[model samples]
Target: MRTPVDDFQPGFAGRRSSVAGRNVTILFLSALTIMAGATISPALPAIEAYFADTPEAAILTRLVLTVPALFIAFCAPFAGLLADRYGRRKVAIVAILLYGVAGVSGVFADSLFTLLAGRALLGVAVAGVMTVATALVGDYFSGPARDRFMGQQAAFIGIGGIFFLTGGGLLAEFNWRAPFLVYAVAFALVPAILAFITDVHRPEALPKQEDRGLISGFFLTIPLAAVLLASVLNSLTFYLMPTQLPFHLKALGTNSPVLVGVAIGACTLASALFSFFYGHVRRRLDVSAVFALGFGFLAGGLALVAAAGSFAAILPASFLVGSGLGLIMPNLGSAAMAIAGEDNRGRVAGLLTASIFLGQFVSPLVSQPIAERTGYAAVFGLGAATLLMAALVALGLAGLRSRRQPA
Candidate 1:
């Protein structure tokens, strides 16, 4: 990978240093990343009961919430190629429109299958929205500025999650359909994205790598691969909160959607708080060090969740997990982009986005059977153990890298 020194040099062309409307638009779009799977989380049980007659309602109801991740995982790579070949703004605008349409389509869905179909379309839209918006971020910023904005982007997404989750909970109190209305907010952003977002020129072919004056594609692939692997593991565990927290709360005898939302929001709010300070955290730690801190907190937090006896006890545990995620999210993106060829930034961002969501889609698949056997609390315990292993691996790798480098 290239040093920070190489990243900031003039060879890499990007937007000006000053903040602009385009930055605001991309940040707003980032909020939708969590919304894809989480906004409907607070309503999962209600939907299941509402569709009690549907085949496999217990599982399919959850699929209505999670299926978007599957679609996004599959479609994001194509979305990236489109963003690269076509214009980023054009792709984003259409995606935003589809996001609103497909998201709200759930309000009229009469069966589990229909809802899953709508959510599937929503996934395709989100793939376009997320991939293009992220690629645009890389196109428009470099070095510390890119790092700062990515941190801000994650923070904003957390803030959005607080709003969406809490709002969905309160809305779910009335009807599961109400929360779907929140997706229509994307339509309002259409004008702003059109007005402010512009496409960066992408070359058809990359330099021969040697002339590029950066790490070879082969060497750069190593860290990118590592980052993608971490993305999958991080998301697999990170998602337990949103996907299982409602049921976990239900098990503890708290059934209010509003309370459920608030419980989930506690984690997101903490994530926002930590994410807002991620740039400061980055300055003090290397990428591997930051990842280690993240996984360590994640492990400890999940362990606490497994042992917590009541709702109040779970809040701080969730916050620790959130903080770990806040620290880890930006580092993964920044690390990948740090080594990516400028021409293929869109494709790379797409792959990263796909990996993250694929992990999310797979989480319930892996966790459900475990939860059935050991209960939700034990599910968290298992996740914590996995995260502990990840933390140890990261720490070991960082030590190895340190030893290989000059003092």
Candidate 2:
């Protein structure tokens, strides 16, 4: 095999890439990235049962995904800085290869530790997809085109979630390891990204990257911490939804794979619809308000889920929760990227992605034990509280409203 340097160049790929091609790359690759997390959540209960002899196996199910998240959170800013200095496609391709291998590892692992190892590694790869993918949108695609892709990004997340959640359920019937193998599909997108994509314009001057001392200073800002917390809290809801809802629904007597799949599928559909509407809605409402409304729905939906004692109740609650998520996440991308600024866009988006990865990494762990100890209802309660807090934070930040028209 030729060395990586032999096949790719290090100079600017024009600092941006083609909108149509790049957006397709971002959407499909991100769908795969999001699928990695979603597919695993539904497989957890089965994996735990498969390894029932070790109680800890179930507790650390989050480890499979979260371990990688730790690396993503730590490495995201660095990925951004590299993208800024080097070029987007080069770094992205490397990260994706890592993602593919780590994801594929799940199919063949023998032990719980081995499985966690795969997930952890996959998390690192995912960090690249998350960090660089978002930055790429800003790097290549712009204005309506960028916004549409971002909306589609959110939509694909829902679509991918449906594909994986039910598919995960189906795979669990065969073997717990089978669902994770699905992540290997990411490799196919590599060729598309490599072939069709060309540079687009990078945003006008971004913030100068911070040095080691300034990086420390950067973390100290109240706004920075708030954004990070907001990101964490946000993922806590989005990631935990798939992880926790299945258990809650199962407890309520809707244990059929078909219904469970439908429930997960319905959320994705709702999310798709919300994503479609966000552009117009976002135009009328400020980013912060849109965020708050989305989160407010999250709090309400979780509230309903917490009280639900029967499977019939889950559908409406799922739609509401998914709707809130759909409304908030895409717009959050635009708003947060704006805050991160141009030069440091990569770093800030990287950090934000990291925060999200960490939150997603930890989210299932946050609720699984709570559900195990207290009950599924408690898990929903915790989700509601976190989402409620997110709403308040967004509402407080309403003052940061931009004069620029909606993206």
- Candidate with best TM-score: 1
Q: Where does candidate 2 stray beyond 4 Å?
A: 1-19, 142-145, 199-225, 396-407
- Candidate 2 achieves a global lDDT of 0.72
lDDT of 1: 0.84
Best by lDDT: 1
The TM-score measured for candidate 1 stands at 0.92
TM-score per candidate: 0.92, 0.85
Cα error of candidate 2 at position 74, Å = 2.5
- Model 2 Cα lDDT, one tens digit per residue, 258-285: 5676777777778878986776777677
lDDT of 1 by residue, 38-84 (tens): 68899999998999998778778777877898999999978877776
